[model samples]
Target: MSYAEHFSLKNIPYGIASTQDRPAAVATRLHDLIFFLSDLNLDSPATLNALASIDKDELVKLRRTLQTALGDEKNVSRFGIPVGEATMHLPIEVKGFTDFSCSTEHLLNAGEAVLGVRSFPPASLHLPIGYTGRSSSIVVSGTPITRPYGQYRDGEEIGFGPSRAVDYELEMGAIIGKPSTFGDRVSVNDADEHIFGVVIVNDWSARDIQGFEMQPLGPMNGKSFGTSISPWVVTLEALEPFATEPPAKKTPVKAYLQDNKIKSSYSITLNAEVLSEGSATEVCKAQLQWMYWTFRSLVAQQTINGCNVNTGDILGTGTVSGVGDDEHGCLLEMTKGGKVEWELSTGKKRRYLEDGDGVRLTAYAGDGVGFGECTGVISAAKPF
Candidate 1:
């Protein structure tokens, strides 16, 4: 099927692809074929950073030209390669990654699951709560995550070993397209122009390590290990058709954080599944609209203090969980902090991920306009 019949040509997303004869190049997907933008003689750069730095109108024009080219058989045959024959690489050279706890349902579920309560911190209602993560460890999807070795307390015995409570967090990552000066404040109204696109993110977690290390300080070694993102970047323009109003907040935010002009959330649905011993079982289903804060809100909060943000910087919506237990986004919340065991496809029970278990997260809007799969498998930890 052609791109038009299968999906909206407007859904053209960008990525990095390589073949046996070709080195890695910036590419775009149409149906099952990948086309290198550099082949189009459009002054395409080698990396997404340069593309992101261009004017928004220029980006739109490039996309439109590509769409027009797709209609020509000669253009398809000249520059397109079967996607299966190519290897996908990390799409962006990330400089920084910030993850925010933006789902109220996720917070409430976590409080009830871990602490026998159902409430959130007061500060969360006012602004997005987030943490700066190690961007160096962010890998493209399909990269195997080695279970990290770290310290954990087991019945008063603090021991160090490969983490027993490894988990996956389903999230959506916003890619920064524009730069901000160190002293400039970006209001919520301007956040859209600064963001280039969205990608599926799997912010892998080591729950036992996090529990042992997170006391006065927040997540450190537990979270710094690995994060996975889907190869394709679905630009914001492609998602505008699916944009919807964010849930109305009961508590009002400050004037600077308010969004009065634009719909900030998308009606995207996400699903997480585990592949064990060749069998795959669906684990969770979530909605991106469940988040309490919007992407605009996060961008404004990050810059309100005069913190500069540059192209390729990422902001992640942490664990996009919904209202039900089955909709919980991670093993820590799904298994009730290891107190309960979830049954997998192989008839095995797990409170957390086991070595060789693969996890896949997928997301989409109406008629399968989607962010491609974000997947990772667990491997045994290396010797100390």
Candidate 2:
């Protein structure tokens, strides 16, 4: 399909969430047509009072309807809703979406910084490296991210306190629609079949907390506190036009990570911006195609262990960094593990996130399938 013909304004993403106006709502967009699952229920008195007011019953019904609509091309349109008529309270909704760390490049870079070496243990490379993160901590864009308090120790001293070095990770996230049981291995060819949609994910980090606890096992307090994602979930079907081959690997992957054929990595452009108190500035711009691994590989490896994945489970394509200096994904890398300073346009410099700092991440795939933006502003740790 031609680029112009593929992406049209009508193709807004779908997501299940609550807004200030309608606490429980299922929203979909087709150009200016905003349809809430609630709108389908014309029988509610609230529906008659305001065509856009989404109630609990409407959301539950929509969820049931969409669950059945997935995987059937004929029923796909049944999930779409107009954007113009969407409720006014929609913008104020609190977003809840989980993220995963599935990128090989991101893992390697982070390891090199802390471990003083490149690459990871052979087991990590051979297997799909991942960890389960908190989904309840997921918040919508523009929400304030509080610096978390956790266990910290430097050298001989260990204590419980607030994070001293807060940080941000630029990542892309995928939303699962259908679920599979334990012991079921999914193939790359069928990976997309199980996927529901995509969203921008910000896996916030407490560098100080991570630095202290990440040994033997992976992240615990370093990750669980809070993670943020965009409110909109652009469907995989919409992103087909932008698909491109995943990055060439430096080494062969294990049998489980291998793909029958090369697949597209979605030619999307990603950017990050920093906003200090009273000021906002763009930090970096990179491409989604730069990923060293594919989302399909991540999903495939996840289920190889026979572990079952649920519908709301999220996977983050770790910080998507490239070879160039400007392409680095987090303040840790951009500043070379805090050894250098990241100079911003406002003439400010940062080694790590500070109190009252806001970080914004955005991505756009081709012309039509844009994932919009996901942002999180930092708040100082609560006084001890």
Pick the TM-score winner.
Answer: 1
lDDT of 1 by residue, 247-303 (tens): 898697899888975578888889999989999988999989888998988999999
Model 1 lDDT, full chain set: 0.88
- Global lDDT of each model? 0.88, 0.65
lDDT of 2 by residue, 292-334 (tens): 6677776787677776656656767878777777777887777
The RMSD of every model to the true structure, in order and in angstroms, is 1.9, 7.3
Q: Which one is best on lDDT?
A: 1
- TM-score versus the correct structure, for each prediction: 0.97, 0.80
Show the colliding residue pairs in model 1. Answer: none
- After the best TM-score superposition of candidate 2, give how far the Cα of residue 239 lies from its true spot, in angstroms: 0.4
Clashes of each: 0, 13
lDDT of 2: 0.65
